[model samples]
Target: MGKALIEKGQIYRNEEAWELFSNLITEITPSKVFVIADENTNKHCLPYFLKKINFEKSPEIITIPAGEIEKNISTCLKVWEILSDKGADRTSLIINLGGGVVTDLGGFVASTFKRGLRFINVPTSLLAMVDASVGGKNGVDLGHIKNQIGVINLPEMVILDTAFLETLPSEHITSGLAEMLKHGIIQSEAYWKRIKNINRENKVELNTLIWDSIEIKKAIVAKDPFEKNLRKTLNYGHTLGHAIESYFLENPNKKTLLHGESVAAGIILATYISKDLYGFPENKLQDISESMFKHFPKQTFSKKDIEAIINLLIFDKKNRNGKVLFVLLEDIGRHKTDCVVSNKLIFRAFEYYKNF
Candidate 1:
């Protein structure tokens, strides 16, 4: 008999991730395959992947609109309908292809379809590969809330292809960079140094960096798969980052913030507050902000708008009881989790961003 294969049943990463995916799928050989993607990934990523993989059969391709706004029950229902029409059954498999939005919605769709089915993630963006691709955490945004509804269904495999990143716009590339920066802050100084030097003009080296970021996430998630402990540290920039994203999502007239852009702003605000309240030091905060300024330009928000965003944060899923908890920085590569900050400090965070 062939040697017994050991399946860790968790996330995997490498430059050859796509090749690994092709091999794994060939071994499993599901009856039917579904490839879920957003409009952007369909145009730039899916065609290349189809040509590379030796699928037992041609997979049904389903595409959804690309953006946070499209991540909802409406889209989820459409994906379900597509799976139904394609005769998707328990024996079928789903391969989610795209950014965080695609993985989030596609995972939700796969988890709920006929109770559940095995799915794989071929995360194409840096943000998705680093953060969203690792955790079993999957969900869709609610009205104004980001990731309000979700499930925890780990993928059968995750294919991390940096080749797809070559097609990403500079803005999208920088957006994903914010998450990498966040991961470095929360995980390792060595990683932070590696990321601090990445430039918008450098496109050939993203594949290696993306894998490093994914490895950071894997170490954290493997230790706290359900997000009950150290995993909360991953929210380093997301507390305020999520609020920023929702605020822009609500106000159509204002410039829309990409997931990483909002997080970049969130990191700046959080670090400033960390200095003000937690003795993190003003110099450290300034250094972080200055580095981020290279990629994310400072966005102006009115005091009223800032307060409104904080108000929405009160309803965040991360909050315990009525108080909103912040993952504050002590310094880069270090964070204090579940630290409760007062409205005064929260307002101060906004004040800092105003000047920043």
Candidate 2:
């Protein structure tokens, strides 16, 4: 059996996650406890979370429709209604069980309802486990712009169990792996080498990789929790990636892109920008571009599509002024944050991605 452990705010391994949940609910002793799941997690993970850990009050369960599209004020209103009707007070505890959408939406609801309520995160997907679940960043998108409305508030605890990945599809795993690669690109050469060579079929190896990712994230958040500077490196590919994700999400005629799939493209474009602007090594740029293409093959973007995606960057919450900003690399494992890129420069980067 894999060992169960707790460090910082993370409860590692499902067995320990169960123990940690059982203990936390008991110790906090809230007037009520609630578990929030999307329709997918309600079907896939909620039963297991319920059976593995017993709750003192049977815990009220709330379900939202699954998908990023459901993340909005409408959903938050519904959650608020449920909490108000259920008599959940300031001392209530909410456990968010699912992927990025569920945790992001749930965290926002718990933090805003009754002014504030304690909450825990039980991330059931790779994206949530590595990035969304820990950062205390919670919010929903505003139309084609991602994370337009949210708060920076930490959860009471987070439970991570790779077992959740058993039922996760390969495409989803690949999506999350994009973020893992971003972690490596921003911080460590060794991590990048290990990640690019990973056998996704190897569960043991994947688990270790996930643990390393969480540790890297933890270190970054501890030093720059508010995203004042260093934590911005985490946004390496997100500025353009989010625009791409949102564009596909809005355009039904095109193939819908997953967040990671979009990020993979964004990373490539950003890498090109890094090469052009920051003197990043051309050989390494070519190598990473090939590696990224292995997981995320090049996608054809029409001039119109590129135009819309670039327009969407203006709404990026990271923007300090009206200028569009990006987190770019000085080199792999070395990045500079808050660099403004011109529209013509961005267009050229996209062109490079397409032709390469």
Candidate 3:
């Protein structure tokens, strides 16, 4: 079994965590229980879950598409409609049983239905487990800008099973690891070193590392739940990263960038900016870049494409008062926020990182 961090909700890890889920819900005896998952999790994981927890009363399962595109108002509307059709009452409990998309969108749905209801998160992806699941950042993407419409509402509990990692492909695993790396760079070098080689294959031994990321997030969230202050540090690589994700999202010929892929790019660009603006060591920047490249392949984005991506930052959710406030690094594990830059500079930063 793994450890548990009980904050906004409890996050439980290890193979035995499923047993805890059964114990907690059986005691509550919710009028109706609903588990929301994406297609990927439903196919790869639901069987194991059903075998573990023989629900005295069968729970409703809702599955949606398994990509960032699906995290939108249309999807939320569909979920709300599904719950209404299922006769879900105020007493119903929602279990978000997939990765970041499911947890974020499902949490938003639960929070809005009947004002609010109990919801648990069964984060099957490392990205969701370490970052999205811990923070009360429930939302759906709007157009190209990511997570544009959302609310902050904590889950009742979070279940993290390292065994689930075995089923994910390398790409999916890489996505989650990017967030873990971000967590390390933002707050804990020890955590970063702990997860330096964490991929799907080596996840079994990274349980403590996973919890360490969660703890870093917990500390950040506890200090700034509403994102009124230090919480911005969590967006370290997100400013330009979100824009890249958005830019490719609308292009038919170009492949879509996964949340973590865009974030990896975001961090790289931010690191470059940190070096240029803050005298961050060149060796440190190279180390950070090399670490990301080893895990995530660099995409060949053209100059035009880079410029287009930079333009999308205007729509980033973090921008306030027409200023693109970015979270930057002074060094690994040390983050600062409230730095604003021009659109041209954003383009140049992308170009610099793309080449460096």
lDDT of each: 0.82, 0.87, 0.82
Query: What tens-digit string does per-residue lDDT give for candidate 2 at 24-127?
Result: 66667899988899988899888777888877669899999988899899989999999999999988889899999999999999889978898889899999
- Candidate achieving higher TM-score, 2 or 3: 2
What TM value does model 2 have?
0.96
Mark the regions of model 1 whose C-alpha exceeds 4 Å error after superposition: 1-16, 200-205
Q: How many backbone overlaps does candidate 2 show?
A: 0
Better of 2 and 3 by lDDT: 2
lDDT of 1 by residue, 1-356 (tens): 11133143455555455556766776777889999999999999988889878776788999999988999999999989988988899989998999999998898999999999888888888788778888788899898689989998888877766777787887888898998888877776687777878764665556677777878888888898887868888888788899989999989778888999999999988888888767886776777888899889888888788888888888677789888988887777777888888878878877777777
Q: Return the TM-score for each candidate structure.
A: 0.94, 0.96, 0.93
Question: Per-residue error at 302 for model 1, in Å?
Answer: 0.6
**Model 1, TM vs. native:** 0.94
Superposition error at 193 for model 2 (Å): 0.3
User: Clashes in each model (backbone N, CA, C under 3 Å)?
Assistant: 0, 0, 0
Which residue runs does candidate 2 get wrong by more than 4 Å?
1-8
Per-candidate RMSD, Å: 2.0, 2.4, 2.5
lDDT of 1 at 42: 96
> Tens digits of per-residue lDDT for model 3 on 1-356?
22242334767766556677777676668899998999999999888777877778989999999888899999989889999999999989998988889999999999999899889988888788888888788998887678888899988778887767777787887898888888878776676666666644454466767787788888988888888878888888888888888888888888998889989988888988888777777887888898888888787788788778777777866678977788887778777678876666666777777677
